[model samples]
Target: MVFAASPLHADTSSTAGGAIEIKNLAKRYGSVRAVDDVSLVVRPGEFLALLGPSGSGKTSILMSIAGFELPDSGSISIDGRDVTYLPANQRNLGMVFQKYTLFPHLSVRDNVAFGLKMRGVAKAERLRLAEQALATVRLEGYGDRMPAQLSGGQQQRVALARAIVYRPKVLLMDEPLSALDKNLREEMQLEIKRLQSQLGITVVFVTHDQGEALTMADRVAILSQGRIQQLDEPKALYERPRTRFVAGFIGETNFMPVEVQSLLPGGALVQLPGGANPTEVRAEGLVGNIVARGDAVGALRPEQITLADPDDPAALRAVVNGVIYGGSTVLCVAQLTDGTELRARLPDPSRVNVMAGDCVGLRWPVEALRVYGADAGAEVAAS
Candidate 1:
């Protein structure tokens, strides 16, 4: 169902409060440091996404915040109250788990009212709250339907409505959309995002899907091997990654070897792949010693590199080796004269000229280039 934007009277104070402070939080599973010395402040009502692959400690951190996995060290506080030692139920946080945990025999309305009933809310008041929560999820008329009678998307909404019926301080989502079909997943992403804004709820979302995080988060924290590699607004993290991991994890990139010849105010001038003239580009906070005088890899985003006519003014040139067609765009893999591989993203299919085995020049705007140490390759897969 389509929902035209409408204002709701959710308590805006839920998000304007202090913050969720996690200071030096660490969790251990036998010999493993599942979550290591992680510390971050989640702003009130802000949507913060913890993004990483499996075993990256993203879930561990989420559990810690929810009072599930107690940290061996560090402290967790909401607003100003110390809930580090509190039990999960006492935390007053709403959670929509990855798996639907609705009762098989109960109707959607009863399932939503369950939380209120447990909290001792009056029966009439609980029903009214349940109906309002259903309305928020656009399931107003389906409250009487049992879980078995609802579609996957509808069931997920029921789970969501159940979590929010009591108006908790924060919403914890653990891959909540992973079970839905692609179209439904995308739809719910928008739905939840709108609901978060309307409710002014501080949402802590956990997911490994980069596209989901990019589409939904106000801020994203990239975690790897129990550590936070980077955290920032999605655009900033994508465009100006602080480490090799950040450069590679957020999207596709082509790393080509280069020699750092000079360092500029906001960037460095580096020798091109084939001893070509130095190209100036930003390296922002990259290790200076790694490129002080030797060879390094230039991190170029796939979309940043462009294929042009042989005589085009753009700098590098290469021979097209293959093309991977995606409906809206194409992935073109090319080989430079130095035997280095380059990938370019063509926005419009019609603009791409070089086909398999065709020679063409490749040019990238200097500002789009990023330089990293030779060891950047090791972290490429992580980013």
Candidate 2:
């Protein structure tokens, strides 16, 4: 679970890595723009994740950076030097793909030394470095085993060892944990974070999984339709998503339609779709031009909502549709009179066990709601 950082193999000291600058990067197919005019800067020693669903162009941008896909336009640079058209083999970078691409005939040590071998490293030195790299990945004894003789996780560790043995300036990983099971994926997430921190290598990780991005990256860029909708640290992106797309994609939330009565100095006052009470929500992050008086959506996470006390008169009425018992929490699905579905996650499932068709009250703090411009997918029950 810890990297074996021997002085000669991996740089375990706290060091800043090379910065990467991408400018107006664009790539296109016959009729579709794979990477629209996009630009970003990855800070030295930062774990930057390019996150989005399929067709979001995250992979395209990554491939272009790796020199696997030639961009139609734009330039990429590392530490102020241009490598826009550099050959992939000459980039001096480490790469880990989703699939385990280890050579079946090569032992773990040989596979780890393959990159060095290509660079014409003497056989004995490469083998020594390979042994050190395996130790760095906590696979010290597995170096003599063939790739086909290792488990998926062990093979991944070998791949990681191979990538780091030559000391590349930057590390690029494309969904490297996608093939692992849930437990392994989580374990690798922590492992990767530790290794990256230890090596001080600039990492650009491409992943469609939001949890993975939030868990591993120092900064996350959420791309959609070949454009970045939001770029911020994990907590900031989750708590104050600037756009509806980001709010919905990063986590599950109930979005209620509301009519903006007025924009206040600190926030906005809006009336819920079917409620008479006008609630105030902090709208400091909304663009000035976009916070006009009209329709908007209120974003609230399910865990923020709770069952109301029997005596609370202002509680909203909801009919329980179903209750699902998770190990540590419970999810209650309910429906309002106007057909709006709401979900409340309770810490204890048996707190107030109301079976299907039972009417109950729901309560949530007004301050917990976040307001956004209403769009087509602004349904309250959307996850």
Candidate 3:
């Protein structure tokens, strides 16, 4: 049975499940700065992901928003109200963690209704709300089952139901799906997104997984060394990364050293090696300010590269080192005469038929190349 829509969901005001603003947030542990002057705003009812490796300060920022970690400096405001010093329980936010954290002794319904009980909700009303929450998570009939009796996925659903049972203004998830297996994790990713859309609740998710961040978030904030490297939509981040770290981290890319012959209006003309005549290509999507005669790195996605005949005039000569057969595509690893390795992703091994130790030519579209200064720093921005 589906639960009727609550009146809370009908409130479309910006203050209802509203925007989250963090301004110049800073945190430190001894001499190490966990969060370094980080600032960003999460739009109302929008799903935002904090993505970065360990020591990148993603978790510190999230903890501060949840009121678990007090910032050494900076402020956090929710819907324009200063909540930086508010207690975690008083913030009226919901949270889910990596572990399900279900009580083994309690039945699923009671587990989900526990928070309501603590808030002085009466018995019958809380139970009714708990069952409705279960139905929302597709676990209506599992309410009587003990936590230990349910599978990992079902237990996680119960945890989700519990978190949303009180209809919080904002939901914070910290790698909540990390404990589940790959298939189950993917299924829950869609489940969480569906629930969030249905309830019109804002979400702030923290994960180190790039694909998860890309697939689930409306906008992703990528952190590096306690700073936001970039905050953009998945398509923008993938197509035009502002930093070398972002380009390498977001997806598979091939980086080659090149000499910048000259700078164009929005791009650069670079000279590539390994051809009879030096192949000078006009590379667009320049990452940073580049100058003539300077050394830079050119980046191309594996799928952007094509294999050609060795004698092709416009191709760079390379020798195939190995081939990896993926389900729908094959990856060819090749090396230029200068020993720079490049990977080309081609469709269908049967169609291409290139073998290991074979001499080949690599070519890509001029617009597909993104050139970056060898030591370029990230251009930080928020949306």
Candidate 1 per-residue lDDT, tens place, 1-383, comes to 00011122222133332379888888899999888888899998899999988999999998988887889999999888898888787676788899989998999999988867765667888889889889998999998989999999999899988887767768889999998889999999999999898888888999989999999999999998788888899999888887777788889988778888877777777877753467776656354355556888778889987766766544676778899999899999988889999888889987766689998878877678877776644332232
Winner by TM-score: 3
Better of 2 and 3 by lDDT: 3
Model 1 stretches with alpha carbons more than 4 Å out: 1-18, 283-290, 311-314, 374-383
> Residue 127 of candidate 2: its Cα lDDT?
88
Clashes of each: 3, 0, 0
Better of 1 and 3 by TM-score: 3
Tens-digit per-residue lDDT, 1-383, candidate 2? 01111222443234457789999898998889878888899998999999998988899998887878889999998888787888776565678999879999988888898877666667898888889878878998888899889988888999888888876668889999999999989999999999999889899999999999999999999888787787899999898877777788988888767678888888777776555367666656342243456776677788888887534555667889998888778888888767888888889665757778888777787667777764423222111
Question: Which 10-residue window of candidate 2 scores lowest in summed lDDT?
Answer: 1-10
Per-prediction RMSD in angstroms? 5.0, 4.7, 3.8
lDDT of 2: 0.79
Off by over 4 Å in 2: 1-16, 285-293, 310-314, 374-383
Task: After superposing candidate 3 on the true structure, give the runs of residues whose Cα lies further than 4 Å from its correct spot.
Answer: 1-16, 275-284, 378-383
Candidate 3 worst ten-residue window by lDDT: 1-10
Model 3: how far is 326 from its true place, Å? 1.6
Per-residue lDDT over 142-202 for candidate 3, one digit per residue giving the tens place of the 0 to 100 score? 9899998998999989988888887777889999998889999899999999998988889
Top candidate (lDDT): 3
